[model samples]
Structure formats: C-alpha cells, structure tokens
Target: MGASIDERKPMVSGFGYASHSSSGIGSAHFRGRGRSHAPFKTWIWRHWPLLMVGSFGAFYLIHRLSHMGSSTSAPKATSQSAQQLRSDSSRVQNGKVRLSDLIGASIHLSEVAAHEITDVKFGGKEATEVKGKTDEGVDEPVTLADARSNSVFVNGLRELFPGISILSEETDPDLEEVGISAINGVELTHDPWLDLNDILITVDPLDATKEFTENLLHFVTTMVCVVHKGKPIAGIINEPFVKDEAAVWGVALDKATEGADLRVSHGLQPSTEDTVAGADKVVISRSHTGSGADVVSEYLPGKQPVFAGGSGYKALRVLEGDANAYVHVTKIKSWDVCAADAVVHAAGGEFTNLKGERLVYEKDDPMISGGIIAAADSKMHAWYVEKLAPLQSSHGDKHRI
Candidate 1:
C-alpha cells in the first residue's frame, strides 16, 4: 500500500500543481481518482490520454466489425423521436427523404436519387433568398426551413440525420415556399422558431449557377453538416442536373444503389501530374452559382483558363487526376462544400487554408467562410500554399474557420 501510494504521489502532485498553475479545472470530474475509484489512482494517472484514445479506437473498431453482422445483433436505436422519418409521410410536393434510410450512411449521389422520386427542384427562393450575415461580416442566406419541407434536395437530407444542424441556403424554414409544408419539432417554421441544440445543416441549393445556365458540366447543390458542439461530421454536394449515377461520372449506379458507392480517398497523392495528364483541356467551377474564379485566376498569371461547377466536383477533379488543385480566396457557405468534402477527403487529397491548417466547422457562422487550398499533388499543393500564404498574411482577411 505504501509503495503504491508513493508511486501515485507524483501524479497527484502533477495534477494538483497543473490545476493550480492553470486555475480550477472547470467542471472536470476525474473519473478514476475520485472517491469511489480512489484506489485506482496509480492506474489512472499515467494512462488518461491512452485510455481515452484506446476507448475511442475500440468503439470505432467495434462499430466497423459489427457492421459485418446482421441487424438482429445491432445496438438499439437511441434518437427515437427523430427516427420516425416524419418527412416521408408528409411528402406532398416532392423531395421526401426517409430519414430511417439515410442516417449513418455515407453521403452519396444515389441517396439523393432514392428521394428524387419526389422530383424536387433544388434551387428556388429557398436557395436564392438572402437570409443573414456570417461571423466575419460575410453575408449568409441559408434556407433551413425549406429543407425540412419542400425540397427533397434539402428536406430529404433533413430527414436523414436526427440531431444534426443543417444550414441550407435553400429550403431552410427561414424563408417562404410555394408548395412544401414544414415539419414539426424542428426549430425553423414559417412562424420563425429556433432550436440551437440540434446540429446545423448549412447548404447552398444550387452551386455554380452561371456555369449551369451556360451549360457547364453540372450544377451541384452544396451541403455541409455540423454537430451541436461545432465539428464537421459530414459533407455532400450533389449535381442537381447530372445524375452522376446514371453514367460513370461517380459510382457505378448498380453498386451505388446497394449503399456500396462511397468513395473515400486516403490522403494526398504523391503525383497529380501523371494522374491528370492530358485527360481534359478544361477546368471549371464545381458550383454553378460560380465563385472563386477571380481567386483561381490569381493563381494563373497569364493562362487562358477554364472553369467548372460545384465545390465537390472541383475537388473530385483532382482526385480523379483531372485538375491539379482547387484554390479559393473567398468565404464559401458550409452547405456548398460539406457533402463533396466527404468525397475529397475520401479521395485522399489535402484541403487547408493557405497556412496548411485544416478547416474546422463552427455553429455560429452558418457559412464556414474561409479561403481554401486543395491539391491533388503534394508538391504542387505545397508550392501554391507557400506562394499564397504570404498574400493571405498581407491581406489579413482570411477567417480562421
């Protein structure tokens, strides 16, 4: 007992001293060394981080392993109230997503198809309406309520996740809609309600419209998701026009329908030049509404360049070895990039600010407005980031997250 106490004394001293040095450890409940588990102080003191990491790792491993098993052995559903898929039963006009089918699944274009039976027109007043301002004085016009009701393009997604906050520039309850009725319990309604506890879903109904109107490759919708605590959980941006699943654009339509179409890249590839060499003579905006062109032009000093549509589409171009990189100098709404971000991250490309820092999600700012530098090639990415970092520093206009 004395030996055990002696060994643990250093840890106790360390904790007490650290806490004292920093100030009262704010609402921290030390689990193992508390009164009931006091005897385990020695074990807990040295292994706090290890335990936490191991616990999370174990849970993830178990979740993945259990996925191979049948539903009979799966854990019981927890978020019951939101699981009932209220949107499907209320699918009057179009764009109905059966939430029961989409949650926990990777964001895929086919998932959009499952609800596309509702024939939802993605961009309307719900998408184009000017809603409000973001944190850094950048303008924001998310359509959250419209997503819950009228458009499966957005509303179907709301039905997918239970506690998530989706900031959609289109279909948000904040604005009026001609055909769709609203869902109950969600914070937004035609009456103007607020539910801060739920996760935020920020989306742009139609990204890159100029490209779409001009008959570009595809006009995609931007969708980004954040949990209540302000972390980016997932992102999806689907082509509103091109049924990527119809052809070989994204997944094999046959494979995608079975929920096996999620494409995740490991990390930035070693060389983008060889991969994308001579594939096409054009580059375009991933979103049709069109942005970042002037910023992209900044990268090309004298080249007569081309542009495409949608945030995800741009990132995917790099992954498919098409474009070398994607450079954005302005703040973009979260929904515009979130869904496609999953594809880019899965494709193994790298995304960051000019400083090479990862972009994070925040609740208060509906649009995760910031400049981005994405690359298919590490060397190419590094060169561009290093070159632009100085400019970003000099300008002092880039927002952190």
Candidate 2:
C-alpha cells in the first residue's frame, strides 16, 4: 500500500502518467493515430539545428541568385550602349551629306597641289609614241619613266591628303584605312581622308614628263584631276611654268551647275571657245599616238591634232573645253586617275574606262591597266560610247577598275 501510494503521488505531481507502454511505439495501429505531422515539443528537440541551417541556406541562395542575375545583365547593357552609339554616328553622317550639295563647299583639287612642279624622277627608256598592242593585240603600256615620277606624287599626295589612302602606280594602300563604311564620319575613322565621302582623288601627276623633256614641249606640268566612281568629275591641268595658266573644268551631272563655282560657272554656258564636238579644235598629246588618235579622228575628222606632253596637261585641255576627249590607250593605275577624278566629280562630270564602265579606286594590283576615256558631260558619255563601243568590245573590253 505504501509503495503504490508513492507511485500515485509521482503521477499526480506531473498532472498524470501516460497510459501507453513502451510497446505502444512498435504497434502499427498506434502510429500517427492521434497526432499532427509533427508535434511542437518533439520537433523542437530533434530538428532545431536543421531548421536554423535551412533558414540560413535559403537566404544565401536568394542572395547568390540576385548577384548572378546582375552579372548576366552587365554584358547585355554594354552591347546595347554600343549599338546606340553606332546608330547616332550614322545619323550624323547622313545629315552632313543632306545639308550640302557638295561633300565640302567647292573642293577644287586643283587648289590643293594644282600647280606644284612635278620633278622628273623617271623616264621610261622604252616609252613609245607610236602604235602598240595589248592583250587584245597591238596595245601599248606608256613604257615611259612615269613609274618613277609616280613616287613623288604618291609622297606629295600623302602630305596633301594627310590620312587618306594612296593609290598610285608605285603604291596601293587599301580602303581599310578609311573604314569600309562611307556613312561613318571620317573623324571617327582610324584614318581621315583629305576629301570625304566616296570621293577618291586620282592623278597621273607626270604622265608624259619624259616625253616633255625629250620632246621640248613647254605646255606640260603636273596632271591634276579627281576620279570619282572611277570617273573624272572635275579636272585641272596646270602648266607649272605658266603661273595659273592652266585649264579647270569638269562634266556636269544633275545640279552640277546649281552650286556654281567661278571655274565651272563660266563653263556651264558653252562659250564659242570651250565647246567640244565642234569644228576648229585640236585634240592631241605631247606623247603622240597614231592608233588611239585615229579612233579620235573618226569622231572629229581633220580636227588639228596638237601634241602636248604630260598626262595631266593632255587631259586638262579637254576639261577646259578647249579640246575634246583624251583617250589613254595605256594601263593607268589609281594614281593616274584619282586627282583629276576628284575635281571632275566635284564639277559634276563622269570619267570612265574605254569600255564605258566606271573606274573604281584602290586596287591591290599596281601594274594593271585598262584604257581611259574622258568626256565633258555624263549625259553625252553614252553618245561617245555609241561611237566607241566597237573599239571597246572588239578590243576585248580590257578596262580595269
């Protein structure tokens, strides 16, 4: 009785003793019979550390996720910024072109190095003024010292043009210097050109210097012309010794006369003196050619054929409207065409190869040649080609870009 009372006293002190025995834990029927998924008291003891660790892990995962998101977004933002910058640059370039009729206000290439005396650094020992032949047969390379003289012009143009690429008989720098895109500002380009836009200046600075020295014709100086789209727009051939006694003119495309300059403005109206395709004018070269000139004779019968030295001087007389077309049957590279081409293009004219295809600038090859055909007006060009088409195709269209 005393012992039972002692056990009963312990039970009463704890509110009550549990009725289930230790065996109750093993019975399947007793499992989860009357309890929640987890009772507060037992769960607290068994999983306190697990709950704390899980809470910290969830917070760390969220924080790490945010940092990762920021990292991924950074490059995308940078790419978008670059795109916007490029778009803005394009707009600026287009605006510059639209606001003005000319790329720059009246760029007369003749004024840049127009009358500079061309030193005779070369004279082709084999340069012949007679009939010759090419791939089509009987074509001739000017075979003169034009190559050595090409170096001085190449160097001079580099000085004059600054960062623009050079295309001469002696050197052919790629257009990569100006960037592939024309719409991009030259200021932004790795290299800036003396003339902007697609305009490329070409010159055969001393075409017939050897012929001039040997022939004693004093009417030759540096050849000056701008070749655009592989054609002459405006050209100036200054007789270095003559002191501004040179001719400057170019063909007029649409609106060529709209923004008139002192030179072409006077030429817009055909003066009795500057008229081409007329009588009483002489077409000649100081370095004479019979076959090439014969082709010209068919167009201008009995027109006096004058002999002028230097390629620029010969081509210039045509620009002045003092003469008709000058046909170069030799292989002329970029340098031979660029200077006069720039001026001619500005003057609103077109220059082309004998095939009537446009002349392109900056070729990799230096020695390549196709014949050149210079005309006064772009519209009148086809008429001349109609006359020369036979010469172009029959001669194998050897015109190079």
Candidate 3:
C-alpha cells in the first residue's frame, strides 16, 4: 500500500525525525536533524551521584561560614558583658562604706585608749580624779581613764567621719583639743560618710566608769554606736581587759552596710534552745540590783542569776553563751547599751525594752527610761517577755529600778 499525505508529516519522538508515519508506534525512527532529547529516566540515571556530592559540598561551605561569623564576634559580646558587670560593682561600692573598715578603725582607737588607761595607776598619786552621774541620778567617781578614753573615742571617730555628728559623755569643750591631739597618730583609709545620711554616733568612752575606777578591768569597755534616724545601724564593744585581743562589732541586718567579718568571727551562732527552759543563766548588774531580778528568778524558777558589772560585759556574756540572757530593769544610758545591743541583734539574738519593743537611739536625751532585755535568740526573748508581762503590768506603765 502507498503512504498517504498524512503519513508524510513528521511526528514528535525521543529524537527529532526527518520523516515519520502516522501509523507507526514503538518503531525505530529516522536520525534527528539537530540535538537528541534523551529520556528523563536515562539522564537522571547517568548523573545522580554527582548531583548529590555537589549539593552536600555547598551545604557544608554555608555551615562553616555561619560558624566562623559567630566565632569572630565572640570577643565583642564578652567585652560588653564585662562592662555591665563592672558598672554594677561600681554602683554597689558607691552606696556605702565597708562595715569592716568602720569596725577596724573603732577597735584601733579603743586599743589606744585602753593602753593609756591601763598605764595609769588606779588610786595612785598619778591618778586624776573626776566625777560623773549615772542613769539612776547618782554621782559616781570618774578617773583619768574615763576622760582619756572619752577623748580618744570622740576625737578619733570625729577624724574618722568628719561630717557625722558625735555625742559623747565627755562634752567638755576644754578637752576637745586634748582629745583631738590624743588620736593624732590614728590613720584611717575608709570614708564612713560616703553614702550615709546624717549619722549620729553615741560614745560611752568607759562603759563602767565606777568599775574601771575600782580596777575591775573586766567590766570596763570602750563603746561606740552608729545611729541613723532613730536606730543603731552599726556598733562596737571593746573589752580591753580580756586576755585575748578581740572586740565585738555588728551592723543591723537590714542596713546597707557590708562586711560580716567585722563581727565575731567564731561565736556568731547564738543559742537556739529556749533560754528560760534550757540554760536559764541570767546576767544582771552587779552594782545596781533592779526589781526585775526577782521577777526573772520567779519566771525561770530554778535558773541561777549571774551578777555582772558593766552593761557591755553583761551583754558580752549573752553573746559568748556564758549566760543565756541579760535582763536589766533599771534605767540605762543609750550609750551604755547601744553598742552591745547592735552586737547581740546582729548575732541573730534580740535586744529590746522589757516591754518587748525595739530600742531607739536618736533622742535628744540619751537616757533610756525603759528597762532592757537581751537574749540568745528571739524565741528565748519571747519566753522571757511572757514571763515578765505580769510584773510589768503590776508596776504600771513604766517600771523603775
């Protein structure tokens, strides 16, 4: 049969054909006039492995570049972090002076006063006679030790904190020059007034003047307290007669002051047991026996009373665990107890009025009319307060010695 006109036209196939037949299917075609178009399956089969290798290499290169970028910029990020930390540190330093520096300076001044006082022979020809009044409104004999100690503390602290106001038992203007000259050799590097408010410092140069005059060295202490608004923020009690060289110092837990090392390093842990039920050791004034002693004895039935000479010494007994608590019903001078109060309170103990209220220090009159109580811990303090409540009620609004 002869091919028709339709069969003469070319048909599309895998390869371009010069001539084609419309009826042909799956038959060998004529050679293409230009390039051949291979089947898609055959092309993929020939180049599959090469394509995968190229794609993997490109991906690896991109990953390496990303990691390199991060590594190169690491130093800049670290530098910025370091700068932020430094700024935070500077702000904290500007806020307040270290508590250790204040305590150290106070101890140094106290030691100087102690040396001067110890050198003077009590009741000897060289002893200078002076007199002072107690919180009980009684005249007591004061000595050169009291005056010299007062001068050292007042002048040394003034030099230490130039801007802060100072209140001392020795207010003689005539002694100011002598006091300033006495502490001429003291050198302090820290500025206590840097970030402080209008601070008031109360000083009892010799806490137990009568005891100091009687050569009862154990009772004598050089005391200083830092008062802000109406509260004591920091304080020091230095017992010169102790065999070992140590002083008790503490800052209020809520105050911005730093440096826990300034406090009693070894004996900071207070007694945890109920003082009235456990040790039941109570400290009272040796010279001034107040009515509270009987009340305390009745409350803690079998507890023994331990008589002590100085307010600082009695408070020290509680701090050292020699006595579980110290109770004083008589009127007390603020400076007489303020320093000890700070130390006890800082050591996780309590120091408050007999009525279980906190004591305030920024008063025009330095005398504390209410009785004071110090215990190993707040739990013990509460027990004592509960026991003493009836006595307080019987005595009316104010209890007197």
- lDDT for every model? 0.45, 0.43, 0.64
Ordering by TM-score: 3, 1, 2
Where does candidate 1 stray beyond 4 Å?
1-150, 157-163, 171-200, 213-217, 221-229, 243-271, 278-304, 395-401
Clash number by candidate, in order: 65, 39, 0
Model 2 residue 322 CA deviation in Å: 2.9
Best by TM-score: 3
Question: Given candidate 1, what's the lDDT at residue 297?
Answer: 51
Off by over 4 Å in 2: 1-162, 170-203, 215-217, 224-236, 244-288, 297-304, 342-350, 366-370, 378-380, 395-401
| Best candidate, lDDT | 3
Candidate 3, 251-331: lDDT as tens digits: 664425432223332224455654324376788887665555675666667667887788888887786678878988877
Model 2 CA lDDT for position 274 = 34
Error of 1 at 294 (Å): 6.4
lDDT of 2 by residue, 77-169 (tens): 122121221221122232223212122211222233332333322323434443344333543344233443443444333322333333444
TM-score of 2: 0.46
- Candidate 1 per-residue lDDT over residues 280-332, each given as its tens digit: 32344433213345444554443223466567667656666666676666667
Per-model root-mean-square deviation over C-alphas: 23.5, 19.1, 22.3
